[model samples]
Target: MRSEPTDAERALWKLLRAKRFSGYKFKRQVPIDRYIVDFICFNHRLIIEADGSQHAENAYDEARDSYLSQQNFRMLRFWNNDILTNTEGVSEAIWTALQDETSTPSPQPLSRKGRGALEGAHNG
Candidate 1:
């Protein structure tokens, strides 16, 4: 994404995109506005940013995070070293975050009724 993802990011991508964690599709170098997210899963409205060391002291990063937050996009960041060094853990973390809350209602199902039937949520 950013000038050929850093080593850690590259390694993490190897594991993340392998379908080890099924149902999660991650795109590299996805352009969102002026910023290009390292990975994004639209179904979950999640953006994953692989931070190289420069992020810790970056004021711009804070503002950027704030703006993304306001836009209702959840940002998940992983340090290059951590992701590269501990890919299994990273995968676990990503999967955990991706899980939908069971307490919340799942999407309503579509009705199979004829045209005469009223359109209503066929919530399962």
Candidate 2:
């Protein structure tokens, strides 16, 4: 893991650290098996990644995601630009993912449609 977090990671960490986000605990720069995730909530088996342009269409990330999915860990990946520029939107998305009950111990990862459903539930 990098010794220092990026600007986006630092910003998101502020919102997630110390149970500031909905009373859920979050840790940064955590290791899970062969991969080190940006942030993780063990209670929900959730991992959040603050990604830069290097992550776009990354095959390694896809494989890593598949591995994590098999372990019943839900991943939320946000672009660095989005995290830095639209903090509220990123937080809301994270909140929706955290509120997702359907992610419980599932072998399959949460699909885009599933996330959209969650968003609809919140908006409705």
The best candidate in terms of TM-score: 2
- Which residue pairs show collisions in model 2? none
Q: Rate the local accuracy (lDDT) of all candidates.
A: 0.59, 0.74
Local accuracy of candidate 1 as per-residue lDDT tens digits, 5-104: 6887777677667454585777777887767777777777777666665665466766666666566667666666666666666676667557842222
Residue 123 miss distance in model 1 (angstroms): 32
**TM-score, one value per model:** 0.73, 0.82
The residue-level lDDT of candidate 2 at 113 comes to 36
Candidate 2: residue 31 Cα off by (Å): 0.6
Q: Top lDDT: which candidate number?
A: 2
RMSD of each: 15.4, 5.4
Off by over 4 Å in 1: 1-3, 18-20, 100-124
| Prediction 1 global C-alpha lDDT | 0.59
Runs in model 2 deviating more than 4 A are 104-124
- Backbone atom clashes (below 3 Å) for every candidate: 0, 0
